[model samples]
Target: MIIANISIPLLGMVDTAVMGHLDSAQYLGAVAVGSIIFSFLFWGFGFLRMATTGLVAQAFGRNDTTLSHTILLQSLVLAIIIASAILILKQPLSQLAFLLIDSSEIVSQQARIYFDIRIWSTPAILINYVFLGWLIGKQASKAALVLVLVVTISNMIMDLVFVNVFGMTIDGVALASLIAEYLGLITGLYLLKRHGVTIKLFKRLSSKQVSLFNWHWLQLHANIFIRTLCLMFSFAFFTTQGAKQGDIILAANAVLLNFITLMAFVLDGFANATEVLSGKAVGAKNRSQLKQSLLLTGLWSFVVASLFSLSYLFFGQQLISLMTSITDVQTTANNYLPWLMLMPVVAVWTYLFDGLFIGTTRSIEMRNTMLLSTLCCFLPAWYFLQPLGNHGLWLALLLFLAARGVSQCFYLPRILRMY
Candidate 1:
């Protein structure tokens, strides 16, 4: 599961590498802005996958085969519905996102091209999200790994053929991604048939056996919705602020953001593991196992995060240079690299607890705490940094992560005590 999750981001890294070779710095910056916008716009609905996996895993644990199938079906239905909505709103969303990002006109136009082509992949992308979560819930981690690996390899190959061989540029990258996602969705469905289906599971697929409006399921999903929304907005706001500073600043921030994303992808392995184990425990009403999972995952998170921090502390500048060659962007990114180094150390607990909370379907508290913290901690820090220029922006983000970690700490004990 972790390998699967990490592949998604590494594919983005590969895309970055391809774009880095383009003749102009503007292309690199355009992909950065375009990706950040879509990341928030699309993956923000990630709650569907997280919620489904937790619910399905718990249902599986309790031997409630019918409920597990219902969860999977509902997740696909929701993904399709949401993807359609994004399609209708794509133009306005693009306009709004670009307006707020405040990049150079050329970069903005390039981003729009990427956004337009990429928007069509929404349905396939969201369906894959459901498929992935279901696979994880079923403990078919190897299948998930294969699905992502195939998609990543296919995407990289397409990127090379379209961008390098054919000179299709950013649009080529977007098209490559779209093609890869549909291929992945098809692959996922085949895997589901080969590895997931059974006589017992088929019996639960009948319409009469499933409820469309499960209150508990809806409530769990809604909480995650709120949580995901707040999280997306925070990053969106961060990008918008960077954009407002001009392209050099935006490009610098983009380089730094990729590093942050790389760290998140690596740590996500531990968190994704917790999601499976913790959700299964909660589903079985095995409270002790849930507690144990959290403790073990927390220990793992700290160790992994410490290693990441050390890597960044020592080689941050060198890594930033590897991502881009523009002198101004490189210098600006190096200035902000320290924040990325601090991020893993401060936010690892928050990431682990997030998986635990999602698994236990304890999302309302998660949402509420995040909402409050974003307004109280993230906003104030950003507002205070207004006078400090770019340094201030980095400081605000640092505080934002720190605040989330601190808030999670205070709230976690209460939930643990309740368990």
Candidate 2:
């Protein structure tokens, strides 16, 4: 899972590196803004992945193959429905996203180009999410790893070919992603068939079973959707604020955000493990297994996070330079390296707790805690620290992460007691 998760960020780094080397910072800024818009749009429906993993993991724990298959089918149906709606509303959605982001005229124009091409990948990306969640829930890590590798490797290759060989720009990056997502979806379907999850399984599901719009499922997805929205909003807000500072700051911030994302995907490997193990424990009603899984994953998460901080402390500037050649952007990113160094350790807890909550299917707590962190902690800190510039924004983000972990601590006992 760790190997698989790390590949996810490598694609983003490649995109940033490709754009960052360009003569204009607007190119990098465009990718950053465009990526965030998709993050808001697609990740808002992240509940499809989280809910599928939690529910399917529980079914696996109970040794209920029928229920597991049902969950997978339902999730796929939901993904297609949501993706269709997104495609239908793409124009209005694009306009609304650009309206909310205060980027420069040049950056906005390029970002729209990126958005226009990438928006068409909605169905492929959403279905890929369901495939990933289902594979992870079944504890099929090797298959899941293969699916991710296919997407990342193909995307990276296409990114280089389109950008370097064909001399494309942000549009190249967007096209690469669109192609790779469909490739991933195709790979996922093949893997599912190999695991005996076939079209025949869908035929076995009755019309009543196929309909998953009940209160229980809807409530679960709703809470997770809210939680995901809050998470994406925080990142989007960070990008928007940086854009307001000018193109240099926007590009530099984009470079630094790759560090945060790299750290997150690395740590989230442990979180993913925690989700499967903890969800299984809950399904089996095994308190000791749950506690043991949490203890081990949490310990490893902190250790890995510390390694990230140390690496950043020593090699941060070199990383900034490698991502971009622009002197102004490199210097600006270097100035903010300390904040990147601090992020891993501070944010690790949030990832850990999120995994635990998702594994146990505790979406309401996830939603409430994120709301408190974003609304009460992040926004207020940013509002008061406007005088401190970008440093203040980073600080506010750290506070938000800290608030999520701390607030979630209060809910841990209840989870344990329930089991």
Candidate 3:
């Protein structure tokens, strides 16, 4: 699972590498701004996956197969509706995104190009998120792994063909992503069927099922929606601040941010394991197993995060150079390299608790914890530390991650007590 999950970041890293080597720093900044906008757009609805994982894993544990499918069907329908709305609101979305980012005119235009081409991938992307979560919820990780491999490998090859061979630059990258998502979605649907998930979208709904999905479902997912927004905003703010600094810093911070994301996804494999084990425990009402899974996975996640930090602390410059050939960008990225090295250590806590909370369907706690962290800790720290420039940005992010972990500590006893 970890090997396959590596591809998630590898794809983004490759995108950064491609744009970083371009003649203008604007290419990297454009992709950065464009990606941050989508992160806000797509990740805000990330409840589709997280909520599905919790609900489906619980259903599977209880041997309620029909309920799992109900969750899947409703989530997919919601995903399509959201994606369609995004398509209709693309103009206003782009306008608001550029307004927040305030990039160079050239970078803004290029970002628009990437955004215009890539926005259409939302339906496929969201559907695939549901499929991946469902597979993981059922402990069909090998299948989920296969789907990720398909996405990662296909995206890399396409990126090479479209960008390097065809000279499409940023557009090529966007097009590659568009095609890759559809391919992954097809593969996911096939896998879902093979796993005995009926392909019928129009299932007859029972009143009880409708009631379960209506109020309970909306409540569970709405909290996750707010939590995800807070998390996305921290990084979005980082990129916006970086853009304000200048193109080199923006490009440099963009490249470094990939390192942070790469580590997050890599360690997320352990979190995925936590989701499966913990959700199953919750469903079976096995408190001992839930407690045990949390302890064991927390240890594993921490060890793995430390190993990642060690590697980054030592080889960050070399890795940064691999992404961009521009000497100025390279130099500026190295200045911020220490933060990436420390990121895995500080950020792993958030990832672990996130999986635990999601598995237990504790979305309200997740929302409240992040709300407190983002508004109380992150914003205040960043506001006071703004004079420190990019240093301040990295520090603020570190605090955001740390604050998320720390605030959750106060809630851990209550969480465990309830279970």
Candidate 4:
């Protein structure tokens, strides 16, 4: 499960690797902007995965096969509905996001090309989320790993073929990702069949059961929706602000942020494991197991975060050089390189604690913490510090992470003791 979850972010790294080699900074910036837009849009709804996994895991733990099946069914139905809605709103949303970023006309135009093409993958991406969530609930980590690897490898290969071989630019990258997602969906259905689970588990659902399912599912997802929206807004704000400054700054920040996101994806392996193990423990009502899972996961997150920070500190410039030889982009990125080094150290606890809370299904606290972090901490800090320019933006983001971690930490004792 951890491996599968971590691969989600690493896939982004693969895309970065491809675009980083593009000769123009505009191409690199376009991919970065386009990716972030979708990251927030698609991943914003990732509660489908987190919530579905926890609920389904709990059902599986209790040996309620029917409930598990119903959860899966309803989740799929909801994902399809959401995906369609996103399609309906696609044009406006794309325009809004492009406008927010304030990039050069060339960069924005390229990003829009990618966004328009990739928006069609919403259904595939959402369905895959539900399928993966179901696999995690069934404790089929190996299968989940296989699913992610297939998607990542397929996407990477297509990215190269489309971009380098066929001379497709942003649209090619977008098409590769969209096609890979659909391929993953098809493969997921095939694998689900091989598992040979009883369809009875998915049936015998009553209207009342359906109603309860919808209510609880919406409750859980609503909280996550708000949380993810705020988180995405921060990234959007950062990129948008940087774009307004100039294309070079936007391009530089984009490159640096990709490295930061890559490290995050790697560290998320531990967080993902924590989520799976902790949810299982909660389902079994095994208090000791839950504590052990959380402790070990936090320790693991620290180790990975430390290693990434050290790597960036020692080899940061060389790594940037490899990503792009653009002297101006590299020089500007170096100025902000320190933030990447500090990101994991400052943010590791927040990510780990998130896994813990999600596992235990204490989502209201999770939602509230994010609300407070964004509204009380981040926005206020950004408003006050905008005078300092980009430093203010980075500082606000760092504070948002710190505030989230602190809020979760303060609530942990009460949350754990209640159980």
Candidate 5:
């Protein structure tokens, strides 16, 4: 699970590393801008994955194959609709996205090229999300790991060929990602068949079943959609503000953000394990197991977080240099390296808590806490501390993360009572 989750960010890191060594910082910044736009766009639909995981894990736990199959179909249906809407609105979405972002003209132009090219992969990307969530929920970690590994490695190879051999630069990375998504979708679909789980989308569900599924599923996912939107917005805001500081700072922050992503996805392995175990416990109505799962996963996540913190503190500069050859960008990234060092330990709790809440399908609480953390905690801090420059941005993000966990803590007492 950890291996699979880590690959998600590593894909972006590869993209960054490829562009980072380019002649100009603008290429890296362009990739950074383009990546975050997709992050905001795609991660907003992460409810497709999270909601599917929660629902399917519970069904799998209860040994209810029908429900499990139905959940996948429902999620994919939602994914297709959302993907089509994104395609339809691609023009205005791009305009509004670039409008909110602050970027140099060259960077903005390059980012648009990347966006225009990659937008075509929308449906494939969303389908991959649903497939990954299904595999994780079914506890098919090995298969999930294989899926991610194939796509990421494929992406890296394509990136090299396109960037180095063909001189495509930013567009090369975007094209690599576009091609990889379709490949991943094909691989994922094959994996589903190999696992011998068949999905029949239009099977005759009772009227009551359809109503219940629609009502509860939509409610759960709507909350998650809003939660994901706010979460992505905070990061997007961070990127936009970083861009305002100039291309070097933007590029440096972009590199540093990858480090944060590294820590998040690494810890998320155990965090996701919690989802499977805890969701199963919820299905079985085993309170003790749920509590135990949370404790074990939380403890293990922190252990990994400790290792990551040390890694960042000790080798951050070397890692920064590996990402970009630009001396100014490397030095700028190093200046803020300490923040990355603190990110793992500081951010671990929110991530751990997220897994717990998500597993038990507490979407409303998840939404509320995230809303408070972002709107109440992060944005205001950034506004007041803007004069301090990037430090303010980093601090606001840290506080935002911390606030998410702390706010969620208050709800835990009530949640535990439910069990």
Candidate 6:
């Protein structure tokens, strides 16, 4: 799981590195802006994955193959509906996204090119999410790893070919992603078949069962959607604020954010394990199993996060230089390396707790805690620390992460009691 999750961010690092080495920072800034827009758009529907994982994990724990299969179909149906809507509304959505973001003219133009091409992959990306969640829920870690590797590795290779070899710019990166997602979707379906998910499972479900849009599912997804939206908003706000500081800061911040993304995805590998194990424990009503799973995953998460911080402390500048050859962007990124070094430990708890909550299907609490963190913690911190420039932005983000973990701690007792 750790190896699989790390590959996810390596794709982004490749994209950044490809653009960062170009003659101008605009290319890097364009990719960053376009990526943020999609993060807001696609990740807003991240409930497709999280909700499916929690629900399917519980079903697997109960040894209910039928219910787990039903959950996957339901998630796929939802993904199709959402993806179709995005395609239909792509034009207005693009306009609205650019309006909300305050990027420079050159960056915005290039970002639009990236967005137009990449938006076509919506269906593949969303369906891939459902497949991933289902695999994780079923404890098919190797299958899940294979699915992710197929997408990310393919994307990375094409990124090099299209950009470096063909000399295509932002469009090449976008095209690579578009092609890779469909490949992933195909691979996901093949894995599902190998894992005993067959067309017969679909045949068995009645019309009412096929339309699994029940009140409970809707309510669960609504809470997770809100939670994910708030999370995306924070990152989007961070990116927009950096853009306001000019292209150098925007490009430099983009480079640094790859570090944060890499750390988050690595920690999330443990969290993914926690989600499956914790969900199974809940379904089985085994308190000891739940506690043991959390303890082990929590310990490993901290250890890994600490390693990230140490690596950054000792080799941060070299990493910055490696990502971008531009001396100005490298120097600017180096100036903020300390904040990157501090992020892993401070943010690790949020990833751990997020896993616990998702595994248990505690969406309402997740929703409320995220609201508190974003509204009460992050926004307020950024407001007051405006004098600190980019340091203030990084601090606000850190406070947001800390607030989420701390706030989530208060809910553990209630969650355990309910179980």
Write model 2 residue lDDT over 247-343, tens digit each, in one string: 9999999999998999999998998999999999999999999999999999999999999999999999999999999999999999999999989
Off by over 4 Å in 1: 198-204
Q: Candidate 4: lDDT over CA atoms?
A: 0.82
Report the Cα lDDT for residue 255, model 1: 77
* Candidate 5 per-residue lDDT over residues 270-308, each given as its tens digit: 878988998999899999999999899989889999999
lDDT of candidate 3 over 58-109, digit per residue (tens): 8988998878878888888888888899989989988998998878899999
Q: Alpha-carbon error at 74 in model 3, in Å?
A: 1.2
Superposed model 2: Cα runs more than 4 Å off? 207-210
**Per-model TM-score versus the true fold:** 0.95, 0.99, 0.97, 0.95, 0.97, 0.99
Winner on lDDT (1 vs 3): 3
lDDT of each: 0.82, 0.94, 0.89, 0.82, 0.90, 0.94
Q: Give the residue spans of candidate 6 off by over 4 A.
A: 207-211
| lDDT accuracy of residue 158 in candidate 1 | 97
Count of clashes, each model: 1, 0, 0, 0, 0, 0
lDDT of 6 by residue, 1-419 (tens): 99999999999999999999999999999999999999998999989988999999999989998889889988988999999999999999999999999999999999999999999999999999999999999999999999999999999999999999999999999999999999999999999999988888777875445667899899999999999999999999999999999999999999999999999999999999889999999999998899899999999999999999999999999999889999999999998999999999999999999999999999999999999999999999999999999999999998999999899999988887777
What is the number of residue pairs that collide in model 6? 0
lDDT of 1: 0.82
Q: Which ten-residue region of model 4 has the weakest summed lDDT?
A: 199-208
Which sections of candidate 5 miss by over 4 Å?
A: 199-213
Which 10-residue window of candidate 3 scores lowest in summed lDDT?
199-208
lDDT of 1 by residue, 1-419 (tens): 65676777778877877877677777888988889888887778888778878887788788887677777878877888889999998889988888788788899889999999988989988888888888888888898898888889999999999998998999999999989988998898888888656546656575376666678778888888888888888887888788888877887887778778877877787878888888888767787898898889889889989998999999999887787778887888888877888888987877887887877778887888788778998888889879998888888878877877778778777776665
Off by over 4 Å in 3: 200-212
